[model samples]
Target: MKSLPRLILDIAEQLPEGEVLRSGRFLHLGSRSAVQRALARLVVEQKLFRVDRGFYVAAVDGRFGRRSPAPTRVVRSLANALGEMIVEHGAHSANKLGLSTQIPVRCIFLSTGRSRELHIGKKVVSIRHAPKWLMALGETGAGDAVRALESLGPLWAADAVPKLHERLPEGEWSALVRARGTYPSWIWNAIQAHMGG
Candidate 1:
């Protein structure tokens, strides 16, 4: 049988750049501790870049040596690996939907999985656990709009409602209406106003 290190390398090479590696994937090759050690050794050799405690990415050569994968990509990879529902936090959602002008210094996300922070190169991505009602919207534009409005609060509803009414697709408005009962009173009122209910 190929040694643990050799087997790990073989598997990594087949994966494209920015693909995340977790020790659990190679546990069959050795004990849990041994697999972790082998993965750590690979990182030490500069063959992999550890994005977080248990997440790693291929160290592909770039213009200035090897570059860590983009923060968004790493988080997406992490979400998939953990089979968790992850979505951009309200501030990011507001900014993306053109409802807010400010961009947060650090990118944040709401996740159904355990809360954690990841450093992807210079930028930081935060994944925080949120209420199931908030996450029920899933990772769609409408969901983002709902979270954004919730974060912006009731004060902004007068103006935000019209902007959202224009930006959100008809289907999203319907989805928002369907989920109205789950939202806070303020948000639900705004949704009501927007839908003319």
Candidate 2:
């Protein structure tokens, strides 16, 4: 965040949703390449958008249009940007990962870290902390991997659990479980049992 220029800061602080950085030339001093470079770098760094041409926004700001991220990419990035208090727990990983059969206009999740509201790429993500006791039977992990588990759905244990277990440490399972909340009891139960508690 220290590398950010004051102008980039200014533009981001001003524009409406869906407006790109290049569109906000409040200070007409730099070359197109320079501005593009700044904007492009933010995008690549997940601070902005190399996601497309002539388009940019803060990665944590809600997204719109037809752009489709690799599932958990947006959520994970949001988690890192949001600080450590929020642990991706306000909603079920499956829904967040786009693996569930249903889609809430708002992106809801479960979090043992805190309770709050977030709008990610046009989808609203809500987080509410749960009791540490409830999490005893859940699993948590890196955002991309977590979304992968969600993408796998109820059949995920068969298709994804082994791979996920391989990627995560033995302790990560507890954080994820704590984040599961009260959705899809059957699926949650199966995952809890498969994980051995």
Candidate 3:
């Protein structure tokens, strides 16, 4: 029983960096008491972070991600737990950028997944459902929430032209389009420049 803490820590270490430990999977190990005790000691030693009762995650600053689940994997896990598609946007973007801005106080994401607002961890996330033709304008990976934002290329004006009216009602879209929506350099400069960035 006492060795449970070390055992749990070892298991967590084996997970991809940034992954957190929680009840569901670990509870399958041994007696509930032993698992609980092991977790408690690990938390005390900073081997694990207890976000709340029965909820723990490995530190994100390091190389592991609880289980090294791909970025998509992580998002899927979060969505599964929330029982919805959780787009990593707004406040989630702030976290990813290491920005000092306040988290959106909501978890809003634009998607073809669904449309509505979601409440997760005291945050309300909004999901805007888009049509497949429109969604095809961009793709997502890694930090999907951010990727979605970046994918709005000005060259995709054909696709984006339809959305510009709604996404950038003001001149910001023109300017942002010119700038090319935070894309990698050398892809295409004119689209962004012509767009007005």
Candidate 4:
């Protein structure tokens, strides 16, 4: 029979790019220590990239040679694996929605999961834990609007609401309106005042 490390390498080679491999998944193949050592050996051999504690991903070979998967792909795969709700940061959302002219300098995401930094190759991506209400609409445009408003705060959001109402699709606008009940009083009041409630 093939050794555990060899078995792991075989498995990793067959996985899709950006697919996350949890250490727990290998428990059935060997003891915890054996699996840990096997994973570490693979990392040293440059066969796998360790993304976070207990998480690993196979390196992809492109024209530039071997490299970790794209940060966005890794993040998306990781979020799906963890069953966490992850969305663009409010600043990014604000910029995308034309509520702000400044662009975020770093790759930042808001998540229902704990705040953590993911280092995929040389690039570092930040994931911050956000309030549930901010993620209520998921990845939709209406959700972006809500996050943009939150990033802008009460004063600016109040001013931006009219534009949002005008710019957003009718369905997205209605979705935003319907979700106002979950927002804080300041945000809800701003929406109510500017949107004519």
lDDT of 1 by residue, 1-197 (tens): 88788788889878866678887788788999998888889878877777778787766678998766667777777888889988888988898889999997778889998888876655677889998878888997778988898778889976787898789899997787788777788888876776688
lDDT of 2: 0.49
TM-score of each: 0.86, 0.33, 0.40, 0.86
Off by over 4 Å in 1: 1-7, 28-31, 195-197
Root-mean-square deviation per candidate: 2.4, 11.4, 11.1, 2.2
Q: How many pairs of residues collide in model 3?
A: 21
lDDT of 1 at 32: 94
Which is the leading candidate under lDDT? 4
lDDT of 4 by residue, 1-197 (tens): 99998898788879888888999989999999999999999888777888889999888989989988877788888999999988889898889888889999898999999999987777788999999899889999899998998999987978888888888999999998898787788877887898576
Rank the models by lDDT, top first. 4, 1, 2, 3
Error of 3 at 66 (Å): 14
Look at candidate 2 and tell me the lDDT of residue 162.
Answer: 52
lDDT of 2 at 19: 40
lDDT of each: 0.81, 0.49, 0.48, 0.88
Q: Which stretches of candidate 3 lie over 4 Å from their true place?
A: 60-77, 80-83, 90-197
For model 4, name the residue pairs that clash.
none
